[model samples]
Structures are given as C-alpha cells and as structure tokens.
Target: MASASTANRWLRPEVYPLFAAVGVAVGICGFQLVRNICINPEVRVSKEGRSAGVLENYAEGEKYAEHGLRKFLRTRAPEIMPSINRFFADPK
Candidate 1:
C-alpha cells in the first residue's frame, strides 16, 4: 500500500483549477438561490400583512423584478476587451 505522504500528494497544484471551477459553480448557484428567494417577485414569500399574489404586487415588484446587473447592462454595449479595442482604435 502507498504511504500517507503519497496519499497527500493527491492535493497537488494541478487540482487548483478544478477547485476554482467548483467554487465558482457553487457560488453562482448560491447567488441565484438567494436572489430568487429575496428579489424574485414570484418566488419570494412575504410575511408582512396579507400575502398577495404575484400580480397584486406588479407596480411594487417592478423595481426588483429584473436583476440589477441585467438592468444596468441592458443599455450598455457588449465589450469583450474594451482596453484592447480602444488601444487599436486610437489614431495615435
């Protein structure tokens, strides 16, 4: 059988990317879960006063109905590499 030192070798630098990928995936899922529970009008449940249907809160829900990032980016153009594009486009 292999020694304990050899077993510990499994945690090498090569595994860092996999770890980062998993961390990002977990973080994204967690963020979506929290956003849905807190900001999503349809998924959210209110404990204040009488609970209303999704349609009842239409005007009030309009604020958080769309994701903040999405709303902000909606009016912006997509830029893959703004710096690089600017550098090449410069006349200087």
Candidate 2:
C-alpha cells in the first residue's frame, strides 16, 4: 500500500501550477461575463395609464401610443359594462 501511494504522489495538491492555471481560467471567464452584462443596455418602459395597453415606441403618451386609438374606446373592462343603478349610455 505504501508503494502504491508513493507512486500516486504526483497527483497530490502540491501541484501549484495546475491549480493556478485553473483559477486564472475561472477568473477570466467571470470577468468576461460581467463585462458582457455591463456593456448591454437595460430596457425601461414608461407607463401613462392603467390599461395593459402596450405603448407605441414613438408615442410619448398613452392616448397616441396605440394605433387606431381615435376609433377604440380606451376604458377599463369594468367601465365597459353598464352600471346597474344608473341609466346606461347607448352601446353604439
């Protein structure tokens, strides 16, 4: 057993160069990951209303954000239903 252990002694952790090379490779990969993330821009959205309406990139405000907004009613789902206690407006 002693002879076998002595033969495998080269695999001992006293090998500093192997460990140093592995550490340097990991450190370089980590640095590259951080550098790539920092170089990318973060996405930001500006909301101007309560609807889940997606804003048009060129329009700054909610009203003009969606195309054909002049034709569509821009009310929430609850408001679209008639009020039970009050006179309802014509659906048209």
Superposition TM-score, candidate 2 onto the true structure: 0.31
State every prediction's TM-score relative to the real structure: 0.64, 0.31
Q: Give the C-alpha miss distance for residue 86 in model 1, angstroms.
A: 1.7
Best by TM-score: 1
* Candidates' RMSD to native: 3.8, 21.6
Return the number of clashes found in candidate 1: 0
lDDT for each residue of candidate 1 in 47-78, tens digit (9 for 90 to 100): 65335544677766787766578898998779
Clashes of each: 0, 0
Q: What is the per-residue lDDT of model 2 for residues 8-86, given as tens digits with 9 covering 90 to 100?
A: 8756778778878998999999986785454322222334342546445443344333436344555534454457424
lDDT value, candidate 2, whole model = 0.56
Candidate lDDT values, in order = 0.77, 0.56
